[model samples]
Target: MKNQVTTIYKQAERFAEITKSAIVSGNIVRAKKCLALAERLFATGSYETKNAISNVYVFSVSTFMELRHCNISNLFPQSLKAEYLKQINTSGV
Candidate 1:
C-alpha cells in the first residue's frame, strides 16, 4: 500500500509538470486534461500519499485557476470554473 501510494504521488507530480508545460505553451485543452488526470490520481491516494503530494496538488490547482482567469477564460467557461472551484473547496485543499 505504501509503495502504491508513493507511485501514485509520483505520477501526479509528473502530471503536474506536464500540466505546467501545457499551460505555458498555451494548450489549454491539454493542460486541463493533465490537471484532471493529476487530480484523479491525487484523489485515489491514501492519506499519507495525499499529504506527501499536497504541494503538487496545490500547485496544479493554482495553475489551473491562473490559466483560467488570465490566459484562457474563454477556454474555461464560468460554469466550468465554478465547478472546479467547488471541487477545490469541498476537497479541502
Candidate 2:
C-alpha cells in the first residue's frame, strides 16, 4: 500500500510537471498527453482501493487546477474537500 501510494504521488508530480511544460511551451498535444497519463495513473491506482481512487482523484483535479492557474477553492465544495482530506491524511499519497 505504501509503495503504491508513493509511486502514484511521484507519477502524478511528474505528470503535473510535464503538463506545466506543455502549457508553457504552447503544446496542447503534450498537455493532453500529460492529462492522459494522469488519468491512467488515477485509474490504475484506483483499482487498488477506494481510498486510493479518491486520493488520486483529488490529486489529479488539484494538479489540473494548479496547472491551469485556477482556484481550487472555487472548483470543489467543502464536503468534497473534507472527504478528499480524509483520504489524503489516511492514505499518505
Candidate 3:
C-alpha cells in the first residue's frame, strides 16, 4: 500500500507538471488528460498521500483555468468574481 501510494504521488506530480506544460504549450486536451490522471491517483491514494498531492491538483486546475482565460479567485464568486471580471475585461477574450 505504501509503495502504491508513493507511486501514485509521484505520478500525480508528473501529471501536474505535464498539465502545466501542456497548458503553457496550448495543448488543453493533453492537459485535461493529465489532470484526470492526477485526480484518479489522488482518489486512489491514502489520506495522507492524497493530502500531500492536493496541491498538485490545485495547481493543475489553476493552469487549466488560466488557459481558459478564467481566474482561480473568481471560481469562488463574491469579491473574487470582480477580480476575474477585471481580468476578462482586460484580456478581451
- In order, candidate lDDTs are 0.58, 0.55, 0.56
Clashes of 3: 0
Steric collisions counted per model: 0, 0, 0
lDDT of 3 by residue, 27-78 (tens): 8678666655555545676786565456445545555677778545524223
TM-score per candidate, chains pooled: 0.48, 0.43, 0.48
Worst 10 residues of 1 by lDDT: 72-81
lDDT (tens digit, per residue) of candidate 2 on 44-69: 54555334434554566565666678
Residue 32's C-alpha lDDT in candidate 2? 60
Q: After superposition, how far is residue 4 of candidate 3 from its true place, in Å?
A: 17
How well does candidate 3 score on lDDT at residue 47?
83
Task: Please give the distance, in angstroms, between residue 43's alpha carbon in candidate 3 and its true position after superposition.
Answer: 1.5
Model 2 poorest ten-residue lDDT run: 48-57
